[model samples]
Target: MIRPVAVIGAGPYGLSTAAHLRARGIPVRVFGSPMVSWREHMRAGMLLKSTPVASNIDAPQPGHDLIDFCADTGERRYESDWDLVPVEIFARYGQWFADKLLPDLERVRVVSVDRAGAGRDGFELKLDSGEQFTARAVVVATGLSGLARLPRELAAATSDGLSATGPFSHAAQHRDVSRFAGQDVIVIGAGQSALENAVLMAEAGAASVRVVARSRGAVAFGDAPDRQSRLRPESPFGRAWSLYGLTYHATHVRRLPAPARHYLVRRVLGPLGAWWLRDRFTAGRIQVTDGRRVVRARVEDGRPVLTLSGGQGAGRELSADHVMAATGYRMDVAALGFLGHELRTALSVSRGAPRLDAGYGSSVPGLYFTGLAAAASFGPVMRFVCGTEYASPRVARAVEVR
Candidate 1:
């Protein structure tokens, strides 16, 4: 009998995982578009937090590689610098790799996954298209779609008049939001998205753009150094990179205990990239309200009013025409509807993430995870597109069937 395998979530991690398994002579069924959500949802001109080279899915093997595709087409987007890749170029790269590598993929969504047999050795995946698939093993590369987290205050205010998300939607449509010129805009959270959008709104003629951050300020650069610099301490990016390299060079990220890895991740990755967009945040006369949280948001006379509270029980009320939340995301298994009750109950969880082994397989047999969901087990790097190279191969080895 032919072995059956399914790769879920056709993003970089999922596609790459499928490609690697296919290359290893495994029969793979891949679903979803290659970078479809990223291309459609993210704003134009948004630069990636990951370097192009670090973002490759499959390790270079003879005759098949992203670099070769770029070389053939003369697409220089594959050779990006500054550790930031543009979204458009990355999308093209993914499409190119998909066309040349794995082309037989299902574009439908997997709605639910459940045990198919009495032995529970095989699994059944139900698709939104009313089709069902039984596979020996399943890899959920669905990426981070289920985890777009907004602040509780912002989430509550979204029902009110305040438009807390999609500040860039207008900008992405190339509409000049100059009508709001000199208008008040309050941005919640200090992440790169918050700062970047705040800058855009300020540039679009918002009179006063204020950013409320739980951190001290808009992130500053050189905070999380690149991996390359870590290999050599005296390199241009400096000691932070060198330290990072030294830390990961000796031991594989998989070998480290999950808790220790997560702690290291919290220290090294969290709030670090927020610094990269500091220049953009500081570009115009945008205001920074750091070390504060928005306690309440209410509409008054069609204006969004916010009550900000600081650490010492201090409070201030500010009004804005618009509020945007860039508070990042959480990965609770409950958010993933496809996971059946048995799988969800069997899998270990730390915080909101599914606990996985070194190869990114969950505690439940034959059900593996990769990319962001696997970050809790794999380390901070695993949370990024850059880490997919490591994650894809490991997952392929674990779940790929002959």
Candidate 2:
């Protein structure tokens, strides 16, 4: 019997996991579309958080890389991770790579995963199409679909007429501001998506667009790059960059103390990303309220009204035509509901993530997690495309072939 390796999710990380396993002569079964989240969640004009130089999956051959694809396509290539990428193009690239290498991948959805027994070497997987199978090992690489964290208060008070959910069209869905021609729009959060949403609203001809931030300005840990700055070599101050063999040289990326890494990420990296997006955001014709927090929201007059407060002040209320949030994500283990109680109970998690060994294997034997869910233990880099190259091989070597 061919005890295949089962991979959940067909997003970039899932596809990359499948590709790596296949290269080792492992019979891998993958579920979902390549870059499904990007196709559904991300806006069209939005660019990748990382530049071309920092984005790639682990390819068996040396030249099968993201930069090479960009060079061949005459796309703009930047040396630093600070550069932007159009969401559509990046998603297309993943599709292109997956089609070329892992054509046997299935796009069917995974409904549930269960454990047959403690002594069993494999897992029982149930698919939405009414198919069931056993795998020698199972890897969950579902990416962001499992969770879309929103403020608890916001989630409870809103309905579809005034709710936050995926597949909700952003600015890219409309060609002109005429669709929003007479509505008062409110954008929450100061991340890239929030700025992009604000721009889209203004361009869409919203009667007015109000952007609220918890911070004084959008908090980015790094500074924006000028022409001279963009030409600099890859380093901490320049933004993390990894070339063909350069990633191995950075011991910090692999061995920093958790506290130190967290501090650096909070004080340095997080602010830098916000800085890069600042200019593009300010260029828009919109209203921005700094240092305000949304404490409560309610639907009033068929529109949404928000009560906001400053760090050291009493609350004040504001209303909008519609409120949209780009507040970012949280990698909660409970998000993987498709993994039934049997399998989930067997998994150990710390701070909402599966606690894993350096090899990406979880406490449960023959079960693993990579990509976003793995970042809590591995470091922030694990959340990005760049981290895939390092994590894939560890899982490929640890899991037995079919």
Candidate 3:
């Protein structure tokens, strides 16, 4: 019997890949909650950084894009290039895509994935539900799970007690932020998560919110250009020729040195607030303090106390009811606890990310990675939803169907 292909996530990448594979009549099984990251990890009512056109999940056939979703569902259309996409709407879109294209998606989580051993044809998968199965191939499309990066100081402090529950939390860990209605909060990081969530909590009736960043000056925002320029062709990521190459021609990206790829992955299209968020964030509800970093953290009286370094407030100590580390994610394949240690160690890595061939295949045969995990290999585009266009079909084509 030909074993089915297993897709280990239900995010944009996983769903798109599964759709493409299914279109080729390749049997496939997809796992994980649809748009779990966007639905559970992100703050509700938040706006996505990408515009409507840029926020699409790829499909094997046309007419399944976000624009189509809005049109078909009669949702408020965000057709303008500058319109911000709502997180809730995008999450619903993911579910709609899955219902129409992958109605058989399994909501169960994978507990572990391991090589079947010498002479075995494929890999073994153990599920959280206690079911075990085998697959001809595994596409790891788990977007941003276990990849949240907390600073060493914040991590140590959280472990001291709260550990992302009581006093310290990651930006994505705000499952019920309404509980902080009357508490003072301190947010660390300069990115969209920090700036946006601080204002969100404040609007939710937090007593006060302070956003601190370690940059030398004010935090930077990648506001859209006033008008399109003919000098550089526009790309989904931005208006840079390099972004065009990164977004559409990942084959060329694989030719770059590993360090260059890693550098681009880390520095591209990140650590900034959307243009729509600037006014709300700077409206005096939240305090923005740049050029300072959280040097140390501890709990005092069941509250988080952070020590700051640099800026005019050098060595200042601040206490807040809650501390959020919005420092963003780092792709370390080893952090994927679902992979067996031996299987993980067997894969070739470049600076904690798995190196991939042009088709998104890892060093291990029949093992593939997409989305943020593929960022270091495929450039910055892999980190966003639109990358599914460049990645999904290729990964589907790469899977050898018996």
Candidate 4:
């Protein structure tokens, strides 16, 4: 039997990869809800950091880009990079991309993926609906599926049963912040998600919102490009030479020493908010506390209390009605509970992420990963929508050869 190649996600990476595979005339089966994370996890007023031109799910054929989708659907398109793309528009584009190019996508959950038994050399996928299937190759494009990183203090508080109710939640856990109305919210982190969500909480009628960060440096904003500037954009992420290098030479970056590569991935696109978001977050509206870290957290008087300590001093207590941990995700293969024990144990890992080769293939042959899951090997570009341009075709070509 000629088993189909399985793409285990339906987000940007999965849709892009499936489109390329189909264009190559390779039989493929895609599983999962289309754009599930963006639809469920992201709050309604959020805008993508990427520009409209840069945010596209690449297809082998022309005219399937985000611009094409906007033009076709008449969804208020933006012509300039400075214009912020809304999350809702992007989500709709994803669904439209799937409907147009991948009509056979299966909206089903892959309960587990395990290696085929005995002499077999493929994968066995068990679905949630009591069905089983075999695939010649499996591409795990599950972006941020099991990668939510809760802070140690917050995690410990949860373990002690302090967070069983509504006093604590992760940034990725909510699609609406209005529920936090009339309450005090402590938002932790310095990144875009942290800052943006803090503003959202305040706008949603939260009595007070405070942002805490470990860095004392001024929060930076991405500079808008001058229209007539001679220096052209190298990547969709930015016009900087460094960002350009990271985007185009991602595979080369992967070949560098692991330590150096990992450091670049973590630091190159470090925490910051969009230029447009600066005005929304004012000092008068939201309090900003820098150079502080939440060392401990506990429930006191039906509220979450955080013990802050760092550059400012030691043992500062901040009590809030709720804690919104905007701490970003950390990639750990073990967190991907969908992969069976045997498959998880077989692949080599570095820094809790799967180490991939040039084609985004894992240590296990015929097993591949893309999107955020492939960021460890490919560089930071994998974390953004633009990475699909490099990842989809490259992975498809690799699978075709095999």
Candidate 5:
């Protein structure tokens, strides 16, 4: 029997990889709800920082790009990268891509993935619905599951000795911010997610919202390109030549020394907000406590009190009804909790992320990872949708040859 290859996610990377594998005539099974994170975790009315042109889920063949979906669905067709794309629109486009290219994708959750057994060269996946199957290979494309980064201090404060629930939460935990209405919210982080969520909470009627970041300067915004500048098309991320090279030449990035590669991944696309978000973040809407980091947090009278120090000022205290840590994600291979002990033990890792080869394969043969989990090996491009353009076809080719 020809064992099927398993793709364990239905987001951009999973969909893109599945399309490439199928195009190569490789038998594949795909799992997970298409765009589940975008549809559920993201707040309503949020706009994508990425522009229209750079926001496509790469398909092996033509006619499945975001522009194609927009045209086919009669959605507003954006003419350039400067146009801000809405999260809802992007989620819809993903669903359309799945329908057109991978309609057979199974929408079940994978509960566990273990080695088939001694001398077996494949994996056995157990599904949430009590179904089980063995695949010749498994691609773990699960996006940010279990990877949300909560600071040690904030995490300790929020826990009741049992769970990290109540009064504190990660930015990715909310689909709606209105729940914080009339409450004081202390938003931590200076990145787009942190800035955007602070604005969102204030807009949702939060009594007060303040942004705290370790950087002393005000949050920076991406520059709007002049008409002359727009003549040269912008990369999906931005117009920087470095970004274009990073997006296109990811293989070169993988070849660099581990430290250099990791440093480039962290610094290349650092933190900033979209130009469009600036207007909403003015003093009238929100207050920003720049250059401060939360050194400690404790629950006081059913609220979160943060002791912050850094930047130029003396340490200070801020009390808020709730704390929102937009601290971002950390790629830990253990976060892929479905992997069995032996399989995870067999793979090599760097800073908790799987160490991947040129083909995005882990140390274990036939076991692969992509998307955010592949960032350590592939570079920061793996963190964005555009990474699929490089990862999908390359991984498919490797799998086909194997």
Candidate 6:
């Protein structure tokens, strides 16, 4: 019997990996909702931080890029992740890619995954539907699902669902920005998500929106690439480049010292918005309180209140109907609760992320990680859609077809 290699996500990395494996005549199964992050998590009318060329999900076959999708569907192309062509078009592009290459893609959530088969060689998977399955190997490409990094102060007030009017939420919670219409909002963090979400809430009719970040000064966008500037070479990481070495040389990145690899992933892409979002966000519309940090948060009178520490002083109090944390994501392997304790314990970790090899495999054989989770080993490109071009084929070859 040819035991299938299970791909645990249906996003860009998941779909691309499965496509590559199938092209190699390796039996594979892909699971999870297609493009859930782009379709539900993002705000309406939000633009992508990446350029049109950088947003493609890779596949082994040629002509499967975004240009082909635009030709087939007649979807209007955009200059970047935002503007006229919203994220909706990109989500549609992912689904179109799935339909074209991954016809048997399983739109289901994996509940748990643990060691299975001889010598704990294979994997046992339980789905949300209570169905059980086994595979020769498992690819953990669960994109940013459990990696949301929320401030401890606001953690108490945060909830995944906005069943009733909510006090706070994370940008990754997939909450609809329209829900906060006519309500005051406080968006935390100094990155693209924070700035863009603030702009989105203002457009969504939030009564008032304010951005409070530990970084100083007004909102700043990254430098656009020009002949004179080499630091801001055009790539998926946007304004950021590989200060350590060649930007896309992910293979070279993995062989570097642990500290160097970590530094490249963290420092290379710090908090900065896209060049195009500059005019969209201004001091007049979304009030900015830079050089401030949220020290404590509590709900008073059915509203979320935050105590600020930095910037001015420690006694500052800011209240809003809701608070949103765009603090960004961290690649922590422990946060992936679906991996049973025994399996997680056996898997090696570095800096809270799975320590992966050049082929994207973790310490445990037959198990692999990709996407942002693989950023620690593969460099920051794993955080973007175009990274699939580099990652998918490597992971496909790494997973054995038994």
Cα lDDT for residue 176, candidate 2 = 33
Error of 2 at 171 (Å): 11
Winner on lDDT between 2 and 4 is 4
- Per-residue CA lDDT of candidate 6, range 297-330, in tens? 8888888899998754666999998888898889
Better of 1 and 3 by TM-score: 3
Cα lDDT for residue 154, model 3?
81
Per-residue alpha-carbon lDDT of candidate 5 for residues 35-65, written as tens digits (9 for 90 to 100)? 9999998888799887777788999889998
C-alpha-based local distance difference test score of model 1: 0.68
Q: Tell me the tens digit of each residue's lDDT in model 3 across 1-402.
A: 778999999999999999999999999999999999888888887888887878989998998989888888998887677788889999999999999999999999999999876899889999999999899999999999888888888888854543445788888777556777888888888878888887788788899988888886556667565654668988875688888878888878889999898888877776778777877887746877777888899888887888989867589998988888888898898899999988899999988999998788998888999999898888889888999999999998889542
Give the alpha carbon lDDT tens digit for every residue of 1-402 in model 4: 789999999999999999999999999999999999999889899999888878989999998888899899988776687788889989999999999999989999999999988899899999998999889999999998768888889888755532324788888888888888898899988888998999888998999999988888635566565532457655686667778888988888888888987787777766888777888887429888888888999888878899989874688999999998887888899988989998899999998899998988998999999998888888899989889999999999999998
**Local lDDT at 212 for model 4:** 88
The CA lDDT at 176 in model 4 is: 82
* Winner by TM-score: 4
After superposition, the stretches of candidate 2 with alpha carbons farther than 4 Å from their true spots are 70-83, 117-119, 159-181, 219-237, 240-268, 271-276, 311-313, 400-402
Going through the candidates in the order shown, the clash numbers are: 5, 10, 0, 0, 0, 4
Off by over 4 Å in 6: 78-85, 117-120, 157-164, 224-234, 237-246
Candidate 2, 12-73: lDDT as tens digits: 78887888888889999998878878887676466666666566766766755776666767
- Which portions of model 4 miss their true places by more than 4 Å? 160-165, 227-233
lDDT of 4: 0.87
User: Per-residue lDDT for 234 in model 2?
Assistant: 60
